[model samples]
Target: MPAPLLSLTWTDHVTGRQGFLVVDRLVRGVCSGGLRMRPGCTLDEVTGLARGMTMKEALHYDPSARYVPLGGAKGGIDCDPRSPEAYGVLVRYLRAMRPYVEHYWTTGEDLGLNQDLVDKAAREAGLVSTIQAVHPLLEDETEARARLADAFAVRVDGLGLDELVGGCGVAEAVLAALDRAGHAHAGARVAVQGLGTMGGATARFLARAGLTVVAVADVRGTIANPAGLDVEALLAARDAHGGVDRAALRPGDRELPGEAWLSTEAEILVPAAVSYAIDEVNQQRITARWIAEAANMPVLPEAENLLAARGVTVLPDVVVNSGTNAWWWWTLFGDIGADPDEAFAHIRRSMRALVERTLGRAAADGTTPRAAAHALVADRLPEIADRFGWYATPRKDAP
Candidate 1:
């Protein structure tokens, strides 16, 4: 892997918390990713995520599309999101990274953080918008911003449209895998970890698609029911941090240890919670035929190898979770409007094609999905750079 163009570690003065920013590459003088706040976040983890963002961007590139892919970048702060000091630390970190956010990096929510909180913190830190760095590329900045805001306001069921797009792509990927294996969606069992923006939405989509969401894991623990838990009730009962209230579970629903989601009796498992959630040891307990990475680096490479050897398929996060990032750009760049149906149609078409190509590439090359995705990215990035120029030298007049 190539080195990141820039990497910085920041120490919060007020709370003494540490934060990290990694710019894996630059395209047209700007990069894009998300900001996550969680305890034990490290530079290494952010580096991997930033690189994954690069792949996600590359895999979605269409020369004729209005939303051209940007470079990769990520920001992370090491502090518990539940702590009172967390918001203050977030504001301080954004303030410290303001220059980059203004000129080079465009970020949004990831993991412990949400877009609402990020936007608020960005404003308090004197940022125009979390993604204002790309304003220069917009044909009409005001109209584009308004379009994106309207899109964000759109909700399907009870969740914001933005939150559902990623999960939409993920569910589509799962469906694609099932199709390839000739598996029936009607009764396929699924277990998902993390009921936040991604996981909760994923469970809803999968359940609605006729797949039984037999188990879902929140910060509290795993909620399991063989006949399938009530996804809507769990979603309604979620706290801001993705924890489920015990009272919301159905009569037959049982709570298990936090890690029980891994061992749940399910054909598909989604680890959407944290980095390295499935390591070598824990991976041994997973009986799921397919693992979709809804979180960045949820499966370590070694564990993935072990699973692959055991006849499991691991769908890489770059393709599965890229829809959220792509949706933002699609709306901002006028590729799609504020319509939920249009947005979902665009996501499904693009994500389905992407997943099909990735799986096909893996089959032809005899490589893992992650490796195939990486190869696709490796091929596309240079073409993107050649056509648009990498903008290796930072522009002095950048705002």
Candidate 2:
């Protein structure tokens, strides 16, 4: 495993809030990742997530890729978002670490943090944000302007960026996987585990794309219908109840244990919740033909290996769910002169191509897609390192 380039921990004297920032790699001169604030957030979790960011950046980078002068890093604060002191704590935290944050790392929202809060904190700390700096420029085109306007409005309301694009990306990847497996999406069944932003968006997109979302799960429990559930109604109910409300179930929908979502017998299973939700113990119980990771690191290595051995097509998170990062890359480094619609169209094309290439490479090499992606990055890293002076010269007297 590659060690992080730098790790820094901080504590707020007033609120007794503590957190850490881990920069796993520096591809260029800068590093970027999300800032997650949760009660159970830990240094180890942040470190692992930082490393995952590095892998994500590596997998996304190619010689012909656009200029993305960023590495991978992650930050977390051990405080619950529901706490009354959340805003004050975040401001102090950012004020204390402004220099490091401004010079070395750029952060957006993760699990418990939202972009609006981050922006507020950044402003309070006298720190300029890359997101804020570039978001305004995307308003030059009609469609892009509308999208940015909606995203900005949503952010102001403390909601995350529109997950429609991300969901569309997931749906596209599912279709690609099904096509590769010689299956059709028309009437294909998909079970989405989690009704949060990503999972809910994915479920909606899949349904819109003509696939049947046979089952859906949230913190409350799983509600399934073999004949397809009304995704729009389900989302509305979830929004009202903070989860899948049992009272909102339709006549044909049946509520089952949350774990039942994992074994719901679908062509595609999307684990879009917490990390490591599918592990060794329950890997054998998975009944999906394809496992698309809509959440970060949803499958542990052991579980992934078991699934791969069993001939399940596991679409890695880094590739399938890279829409957010890709959007940021476009905003930060894409052709500013181009129309916003054109820029987004380019991203869609590139993402689809990446999925196709990774799947093709995996098939040709007889390896899992995750392994194939890592191998591609591994093969390219030395060259990047050499160019960026990341390599150390060997000493003549060294043993």
Candidate 3:
């Protein structure tokens, strides 16, 4: 049996305190993951994420026929970050598991913790802090690492991390789908649901890409403007928690049911808000030929099947959002620069490649984009699992 590419280790130092490290694929390139904090999160989940990261990096680095092994890894802390004491405790927990912080086990931000939290935790754990207030050159490196970490953290702290990835990944996938359909981003009408980090980022990116963002929705309500909503203006009006000031929206903006954005007449619909936002009930009302899953599990599997049957191509989350997190992992322990633009560029390339590959697979299989993309990962899973003996015999299902 092949040894596992992914391994899980846990340490118990402080009483009632525990931490886990999951090592995914061991790419000759670089392997990276995040430290997540959540209530009731199990070790199994962390390991699964590590494995996913491995596949993500593999698919991203080489989406073609060749399966180049790219290392992937992740870690998680079971705790809440809302309290100051919990924050300190979280740091101590990370410190206890510092031995795993390496090129193979490099960690970044995940659910429940932000970049600030990771930086502080790393500091407490005695891992060389990314911050360098002393050396000028070191400071540049520190700034770059911090921004990359911050991007991953904010995705979790502000909007649910999974949701953000799903939203943005789907947005990119939608753009690819539109291109396949011969539709253009320039002057295309768009509506976004769920205006958190993922939704907000998608809306901003689409607008920047020259799409006419006509509407956006959050948990609070929906805001629409047929003349194209002002992305920057709306962003400026957002509260500390990213809530938009409905009163500050443009004159034509009017409040409607939170789910109303799904039915808008826009040519592109981005459900960046929440899971099941485009379920069976409202699936038929979706007027946009292009629908992106900005939130994880946004469409029920059955619903997704239905959408594919009806000709709407859905982009899967695992493939699309993998870039930002993947880039964060690579740059954190490597020679990444401090400038945010440079960091963003590194991630965009990975994202663009995955999108192109997924689209190509869809064209070849005559299936939904998600299936084609997932198949790429699924097809490789066996060789990987065989190499690790994960599926030896009756599927041990070992933890």
Q: Please identify model 1 stretches exceeding 4 Å from their true place.
A: 392-399
lDDT of 3 by residue, 1-399 (tens): 123455565544553645677665554323567677755556766776676666666575433313234456667666554544567667676666655463235565555555665787687778774222111222245556565455444433244332344334445666666776788788899888766556677787678778899888875888998888988788767763357988787778778888788788888777754445677767888777777765444677777888778777666656755655554444544434434455455555556677788888888998787678768877775665555334122212225
lDDT-better candidate, 2 vs 3: 2
Give the per-residue lDDT digits (tens) of candidate 2, residues 229-313: 9988887777521377677788999988888988997989998877778999998888788999987888999998888888788
Error of 1 at 98 (Å): 0.5
Segments in model 3 whose C-alpha atoms lie over 4 Å from true places: 1-31, 35-51, 62-89, 92-104, 129-172, 273-285, 329-350, 378-399
User: Of the pair 1 and 2, which is ahead by TM-score?
Assistant: 1
Q: Give each model a TM-score.
A: 0.98, 0.84, 0.69
Report the error of model 3 at residue 151, Å: 11
Give candidates' CA RMSD values in order: 1.6, 6.1, 7.9
How far does residue 329 in candidate 1 sit from its true spot (Å)?
Answer: 0.3
Name the Cα RMSD for model 3: 7.9
lDDT of 3: 0.62
Q: Each prediction's Cα lDDT score? A: 0.92, 0.74, 0.62
Could you tell me how far off, in angstroms, the CA of residue 232 lies in candidate 2 after the best superposition? 2.0
Judged by whole-model lDDT over C-alpha atoms, candidate 1 comes out at 0.92
Best by lDDT: 1
Which lDDT value does model 2 have at 298? 89
